[model samples]
Target: MNPRHTALALAVVLLVAAVAPATAAAPVDEDAVGDLTVTTAPATASAAAAAEAATASDATDSLVAESDVAVFRLNASGVPAEADDDGTLLGDELTLTLRQTASSVGVNETAKTLDASADTEGVAVRTTESAVYVAVDIATTAFQQANGTGTADAGDSFTATATVTDAVTDGENVTRTANFGVVEPSVNFVGGVDEATAGGTVEFTAATLLAPGTSLTIALAPGEGESRTTTATVGTDGRATGELSVDGFDAGEEYTVRATAEGTDLNATVTGTIQAAATETPASTPTATETAEPTGTSTSGPGFGVVAALLALLGAAAVAGRRA
Candidate 1:
């Protein structure tokens, strides 16, 4: 071979080695290299799209939680106070109470009544209690209006009424009357009853308690050999008056008085006794305590020693927490 041609081929071989490695390493765009393939978007834009999808999912969950809570409240309002039971009848006040509570800690519904169960939703319920009181006015004049009642006689029929309603704001009354009925009492009087013989008037009395105009049957029982009965109405204290001849009684006979009353709104019976006056016992009353007992240094019961030890230990914790 000729020396010049051999030298030239050697130079071309070295040049090809260097240029081939450089061209292979160079970056190539797929979209530029192919007519149909496309290059992808930037990494930052793809990440933002993924984050937006997650945010939308969280927003849907938040909207479902705020709409489905149940609630209720007390029906009654302010009212005036009244007295307790006494001989005289009066209007009484009524009170209504309310308790609002959740059926479960979470996944339950809120409502007025607890009997109806709540559904299992991812929800929390809150509860509260409130109360209201209303005033009512009851009078004897109300009784006259209920029954077409004029003058009442023995064994007559009548009716009484009862009602429940809201408290009155103005001078007017508002009541939801539930019921009213009339009734009579049962009372009987017998034995020695001196009408005008003694320093004071002596009258036989029998009694019962209940609503007025209510029917009543009385059964009387006089002591030992005395038995007498009468038909009459009982007063508010459940008392009916009758008279028996005291003049003709044997010198030392036992006597008794009894009465019974029956009515729709009232029913009760009462009795009294007639006896010879006897010696009375002196009355004794309880004395008031002047000195109160000391409460210090008490050391009794099973847990007293344990409580003392606990109190001693608690002082250190309190001091440490306060200082810190």
Candidate 2:
């Protein structure tokens, strides 16, 4: 071979060797490259109840509700190679579904098809790169039915299955099952004053459908001040009344009053205002005597004593003349 041709071949071999490492570093397995996971936190009502229960030092009540039932967190390793060059996960290719496994536990089907192009507030998606994280809040009607106003227990147990699929990858879809219990207690704030004077007494009434002898925590959170917490015990009829002093709260400030069962996730809240104390005005006392004209006498003609004296003198003079 020519010397120039041999030199060119040698140069090509060296270039190939230099680039091989980078090509081999790319991830080949889909699971190794990306992952999806879901986790849950206490529902809103459940958390409130738990807070109250903690204050009361009771451990018998447990609760859950529909308003803040389940929170889901989704994390992806990076933009999967299967995603489009713009880093958008195809809606049809990527999907997440949630279903109830236990027949006794009633749950609605929650299926979401992700669209990287669509505007989803909590769902993470990128047009030029992979979305690393997304969060979803799941709402279910089952929780509402379970949170009744009766004394009976809502339900015994709950189980749910979550499945995530990536159609682009040949790897198996990921599935996870979560087990939960519907053990939160239920409480309602039935009656309370909407406003109270500073340093005055404010009373609250709550109804807990739990068994008697259960302890409850009453919390008063002012809009701008520290919170006041108190404890009460359930009566025979599941009714409890608590009192809070409005001493530290500022006048005209708004506050929220919440009642929760001890050791369970059941609670209620009401809004109220701290009113300013009223100023007392003392009654005016009457003066001893008021300056005024006499009621029966005429002021312009007053001289009765002098007139009487003159008449008496005339009468005496007339009598003396008669005698003379």
Candidate 3:
């Protein structure tokens, strides 16, 4: 009951407080998944009309007559870690599915099932470090439903949605949708210099509907042989200009030049004629020759001999008449 005993009891209480288990922090929410992004590749078509429609559409077109494929990517950097000591994340239990929505044009697949329990058709999933990608192939019938039975035309559009759900949590899902349409790119010859001379600078300008900053290739196909190619970048105004060297191109020949957008399926072409350079013909030098006048008299005229003989005969005749 003395001061020394009281100091010893206080030290024991402080030691116990320092060693006691710290209260656990709250568990991270399982629904805190990352963003879902949808990207598309160049679409393929079974028929010529489908390909043409795909080229005309600016929006991503995975739609084809037989099947169209859609790609979905998930970024998990924003996701939180689980509360357990293993240090795992909630993305491990995530599932993705892509479904086609009703449109004026019909499409094939209504929905793609990507859950663990189901082996749905035409759906594949690949996972990487904190990221997952889901791909689905939709049939042409799906798009045809909205676009009608015949060949698809320009301005036709199809809609699709991608959904991500957490398998372990109830009512936890995220979705993103995109609309695609048919877009046709146009190209025309903007006219180069009135005359493209041989070994001179030639420039070609074309207008397109593709987005700005897109890379494009301009191919110049002469009447014969392999074609020549030049590169041009699209301007903010949706126009691209490329320069061509007329060194190898034949002068006075017409060539068909095409400008194709690099990333998208759009191209424009024009016909142009290469002008022949003007050539000057040299003047001929005049040659000088001595032209002599007639040197002798003409023999056909009366000669001195003929005149003397005539005079002699006249004298004789006169003398004879005197004698008689």
Candidate whose lDDT is highest? 3
Q: What local distance difference test score does each model get?
A: 0.30, 0.49, 0.50
TM-score of every candidate relative to the true structure:
0.22, 0.34, 0.42
In TM-score terms, candidate 3 sits at: 0.42
Error of 1 at 151 (Å): 34
Clash pairs, model 2 backbone? 61-263, 61-264, 62-183, 62-184, 62-185, 62-264, 63-183, 63-184
Tens-digit lDDT string for candidate 2 (173-244): 554444433334577776546777888878877775554555678888888767889998767566788798
- TM-score winner between candidates 1 and 2: 2
How do these models rank on lDDT, best leading?
A: 3, 2, 1
**Model 1 ranges with Cα > 4 A deviation:** 1-202, 205-208, 215-222, 235-239, 262-324
How much does candidate 1 score in TM-score?
0.22
Query: Where in model 2 is the C-alpha error above 4 Å?
Result: 1-185, 286-324
Q: For candidate 3, what is the lDDT?
A: 0.50
Which candidate do you rate higher for TM-score, 1 or 3? 3
**TM-score winner:** 3
Report the lDDT of model 3 for residue 300. Answer: 44
Arrange candidates by TM-score, descending.
3, 2, 1
Off by over 4 Å in 3: 1-31, 42-70, 75-103, 106-124, 128-131, 135-156, 168-171, 182-197, 201-217, 224-226, 230-243, 248-252, 259-268, 275-324
Give per-residue lDDT, candidate 3, residue 20. Answer: 94
